[model samples]
Target: MIQMLVTGPKPESVAGRRSIAVLVVILTGQFMTVLDGSIVNVAIAAIRSDLDTGGAALQLIVAGYVIAYAVLLIGGARLGDRFTQRRTFIAGLAAFTLASLACGLAWNEFSLIVFRFGQGVGAAALAPQVMTLIQRTFTGAARARALSIYAAIVSGGLLAGQILGGLIVDADLGGTGWRGVFLVNVPIGIALLMLAPRVLPVTVARTDRTVDGLGLATLTSTVLLLVVPLVLGRELGFPLWSWLCLGAGALGLAVFVLVERAVTRRGRDPLFAPRVLRAPGLLATAVTLLMVMGTFGGWLFVSALHMQSDLGYSALRAGVQFLPMGVTFAAAGLCWQRIPAVAHARMIPFGLVLSAASLGWLAWLSSAGAGIGAAASTAFALFGLGNGLAFSPLMTRALAAVPVTLAADASGLLTTSVQLGTVVGIASIGSVFFELMGTTASSAADAVAVAQLICAGTALVAAASAALAVRRMH
Candidate 1:
């Protein structure tokens, strides 16, 4: 079956110079999308001060992009299926680039929020295609290597965003302040736009171009209902409307399942094929991804707060603190394929255990009154190494479980799990951190310790799920 999938002429074979260019272009797209997700964090204070933004609006500025991106992702992948990956990718990139410009030039809080949402829309359109392109273009060992690089970019982009955002905001380049963060993408986007058309492979479109209108609507609404509340619930004190949205979102999920099944029965391509969920090992992989990403997200959020708000580190200093972890993560991701294939399944569980242990170490350091010093940094690096070992392999496994024909579906589903996990983690663990951060630095340190333990627990759960996924794969 695997041979049959790769027997055809490779769409754009992952070989030599051309393959390098293709990866560069596509991965750059992925990097930009991921970068924008976290880049605004360090800039938020600058944005609020510059725009005189209110608290609710400030929250929206931060979260609006994620909500839109998560809601539209699966549909975006379906678009790639209908339109061809190359075309959809270019179009999405165009939208994202222009939105970045708009965000940079925004006149007020409202404009920035709206433009940020536009950025999300463009990201939604582009991101899944990155993985889909990799899936379609590469096979066998070559595929694994490409995925490792892809995973590295995902992890690295996140850390880079923090570091770059701080540097940009601190420099206040051309007095742009926080605006520089958005503007930095403009040139990169333009260069990619020019190169993408020439470099990207021409993928064949799906035969069934028929739109799954109901599926799209229901799925989008469900995601929006779930994501918006999670993104804003803590800020708004989890009001009645948030709970109502959660309830409605649950109902919408059930309806969405029914709608997709109906579309499948009618012999039409649904926005998301429900059968993809039933594929061996896919569900377990999704659960593992959700927990893993959630833990990472929660750590990023609380760690930043603890470092800056409590420890009196500047934004630039706080951002720099992540370097050890990011470096190790990139190194581990690039090197993991060196391990023998037979032991690959064990890597996920072992890596997750490492991550959990590292998190526990971090908790111990925090509780023991250790600041962001050498010991804590070592813990961070270890956690990153562990995550690096697991993430790429896990992604490869998830895609491998499904037919190549459903690449877009698998990509979309996996990415959505990751994004949703980030939101869920920040909301839940962030709330705990805030609750515990009472009067003094000691209290805040204690809060961070508890949060680290919670994250450690989450990582262990993810490890169990990953083990289950590996078992199911065989």
Candidate 2:
């Protein structure tokens, strides 16, 4: 059946349909993984109340998944390259589904934390394959359209997680409470698992199948050392050990670079190909993505705090307030392709500038005590539109700059930057927000306004980076 589909006459239509199916299945997986990251946020209080979890344990339950996911992402991408994306994706999905079940059934805080980490490991394995499949399966306009949709899903999932989580916890579906958040993945995963093998195309595995054990170990260690501290430092009050780990992480990064170079010189495949980094415009794109995502992460965190803590909004109400932003973001992502291709390169910086402007508007509104009214909602919508315009095009250009052979490496690098940026933004900007709130003179709205200004500044820097990327590429 697979052979016939490949060699069959006038197979373009069939192939197109298959591509759509593949996108649906894999993107469903992507949504599940991405949603899980933020879905637990609204449920934290419920979980803590039910399981008697402490602050530290609760933090772990949240951060552990992210740490494992970020650390193993590149390795997971390599696995797809080595074992074929279809096979690895299935394995990852299966692992994720089972882990979700375990999380739902966890009896204690420790058990739930462990299961959450397992979910992250599975997600690490699962997430990269979505991009890899998109790269390999589609071409030209189709690829652009697919990427736009992918960006929407990635962005929307974050907001949707919070909204859906609030609804689920408030409704207490079947009296499952917080457990419903994790268990929600079960049916979706099973459906995707059944459909994937039929719809997903089989591709030839890479001939250089050898694993780079040293490169993998060093890279994982470096990321673990770096991400662990960033995720935990605020909760732990930035202990001396956290600082030491960060220093060691910096050194470990140097070691990893040296090891990868040595492996490349030996004609052996490194865990991450260094040549991918040398790809024109890639580094600038990475920097742009880092800053853009940082702004987004910070905005989400601080805005939620302002709404809930200062404005006395419920979780669901706060999540619903973000609906305008999500809608505008998805609309912009999908419609960007309609714009002239000649102007697409310029859109990144334009979008960033627009985002910065909107963020500044938000800061002004917050400071003036405008509250969550039409004006504030409009600003949120504008911010979303700007981000939507920037993100998809940035991703398309970055992937286009690299050779198809290094799709895995490019995917790993881009995705890792996004994840790291989110973690760093939350930690750093969140610290500033907390510190300002603690001051006697500052109100919650004041802290949020300051955070928005910082986010606006980050967006402006990202705009500059995007302009630089355009120059390098052209």
Candidate 3:
């Protein structure tokens, strides 16, 4: 028999002294996850050198973590709902810390990749609980504000990771060098692990439900089959295996849908609650994120390439060039709390339009040449504002109506969509840009303009979809 999860929360308000404690714990967990994501990007070369890893192996170092992380997210969230989120969280932290130590002390690329996968496992277990806990703790107004702050900080955390990545590798920190990057997390993880059990609530799961193993297998296969080939395909010139992986990925997804349906027919809560997928509000929210995050990821990848490869900016300089946009994102996140609650969902559609406009303008400006500094300024500010307003609202709105009983599964669904979108975005756009640039007899300025145009087009589609979805919500 499928047991219904016991929806236990301390209090909805989380006001005064008690709620404050929980808030810190929840936000801390979120920051850690966001931080780890981008932190490794800037340090990839350092790791490769220290471990004597090759390009393929180093890519594995990153890809392994990401693939494992993405595959396990739904499973982790379901586990949290089946057990206590608090206990699951504490355990995840402990494992993550230990894994970080293993990563730092590793002697080879193989060990590093394995430990990184372990790290991904820990992150998967820990992440959804952040959303689940926030839902349990706050009411309407407080919840919206907290989500905005969370979104903004998560954005900043990614940017800060690049900065820290540079500083740590350069500082060499007693010649432990790249090792410091992983080692630094150990102490923080220990501290959070210790504090979390004390501050976090142990919401009970009434169900002793086991995970839908068939569903898990099918989903994992779908992601790997799709992402691995796409990431490697262009570089390998789209070999036969690439075509096979694509076909297999599609097949796996088909099977997954069938499996979910079968489990639901048996009167059990499937790997994901089918009911959650049927909610217009929830599904809209997920689709919005799917498009929004894809645009964001595309922008990040293309902009970095244009700035560094075409414009001749130093690596650090290229990163700094993005500072204006990053700062604007941070400011909006901090101030988003002051905005009226009734206006929260409205901001998403508006921001989507603004983002589309910014992308459109930036493409024109880049086409005019890098000397159009003023145009660049305008584009960055607009893009930042749009993203800041849209992302948080999209997340908050999609999550608002999800009952405590279904929180974990729903959160997992969103997380999966977000990551999958990013991977797909990079592959789809990056492939187009690289092919177009290589074959064209155009100047560097023209090539960048082409890439920007692609990004603008994607952003435009995202904006339109978001608007349509929000309209349906009303």
Candidate 4:
């Protein structure tokens, strides 16, 4: 099953072939990392009830992982460059597996949050290597196919988290309930860890670059300050301390940018490569990707809560409702490359617009109290198709302009933007939904309707970004 590609000068076992086995190993790491991002939401209620914790603690269980992952992504990517992609990938996967086990055994909220953060750190280490490996291992149409499949899996993982979490919680295997969600990653990770060294292609480590310690510290502070208040502020009634934290986060970001620019000017490697910033369509793609993917996180959060809390659906029923979206996403991703060049260029924008419209329709249906029936299912399917068409092409086009040398850096930046987008969407939009539900005494369905409206608006802007990117491409 393995086909030898441009095998490098490494040992025979680690070089000389690109196989499905290698692809699976890389993509599985990606799937696990992305899966952990959203799986906990489905089990949030169960986790709270079982652990006897409050809403704030539950939010931390989710947000802590994201924050850690987002802040460390660039550093993780740098590690891949400095310490060989294969080594970092294996190390990260091992750490992630151990952390997942710890999370399952956590006896209290504090322990769970700490372990979740560790899981994020592990994910950050592995994420950039997935894309880097793809860039190194494949070329031409094969590369395009690989990237498309990767995109599908990433999007699919977001939806699957709910499905998997729901199943585990409903099964209550060994009376563990929500803990099974984390535990399930253990065997899978262990299998990947064992197989990786035998199948993965090895590349030379770039030792010229070192970690940007100052840049890392400043960026971490910036992300924490911005994310922490949004997630915790409303729960604490928007205390003055939270407002101060937001202000400080803004200041930290300013400092981070200046530091990065200086680092670039001094002929030293910065956390973010200066050259990547100059690439056409890169900035636009990053913004659009963030906006588009952010909605995925926010949508799942509000929808899961509304379905379980308001519609009184069982966990299984709630998760099943998203099946339509997952199916269409895979279908559209597979077919996107078959379209004509002219039409293909329009795919991202058109998909975004279609997704926005579908989401808006779903919002209307929710407000009308149409439950998880045929109409809502159809809407989700349409939304998924559009999202599929947009994301696969968007990622391919975005990275098409990146230099091969900076592939790891670009991957890190892309993944960081994604995690940040997901966290922000969950914190801000979820906060809006929760606050509205409390103060207005609106039904959960009604709050979800309002939240979906915000998501729809973000989709519209993403469409605009896609349009701009297309123009730049031409």
Clashes of each: 0, 0, 0, 0
Please tell me which predicted candidate would have the highest TM-score against the true structure. 4
lDDT of 2 by residue, 1-474 (tens): 444322221112225567779889989999998889777766766787899986457657766777677778888888888888889899999999999999999999999989999998899899988888888777777877888899989877987987998788878889899899999999999999999999888877664655788998897888778767765676678899999999999999899989989999999978767778888888898889989888987688667657765676766777788888888888888888889989998888999999999999999988886679999999999999999989988889888877666777788888877776775676567667866775333476788889999999999999999999888888
**CA lDDT scores, all candidates in order:** 0.85, 0.82, 0.72, 0.86
By lDDT: ranked, best first? 4, 1, 2, 3
Candidate 2 local lDDT, residue 381: 91
Given candidate 2, what's the lDDT at residue 138? 75
Question: Which residues of candidate 1, in runs, are more than 4 Å off?
Answer: 1-10, 52-59
TM-score of 2: 0.91
Against the hidden true structure, what lDDT does model 2 obtain?
A: 0.82
Arranged by TM-score with the best first, the candidates are 4, 1, 2, 3
Cα lDDT tens digits, model 4, 228-311, are: 999899889999999999999999989999999898888788888877877788878888888987887788888987888777
For candidate 2, the per-residue lDDT at 469 reads 88
Candidate 4, position 365, lDDT: 94
How much does candidate 4 score in TM-score? 0.95
Worst 10 residues of 4 by lDDT: 1-10
Off by over 4 Å in 3: 1-13, 45-60, 106-111, 176-179, 302-316, 337-346, 364-378, 430-450
TM-score for predicted model 1 compared with the true structure: 0.93
Q: Which 10-residue span in candidate 1 carries the lowest summed lDDT?
A: 1-10
Clashes of 1: 0
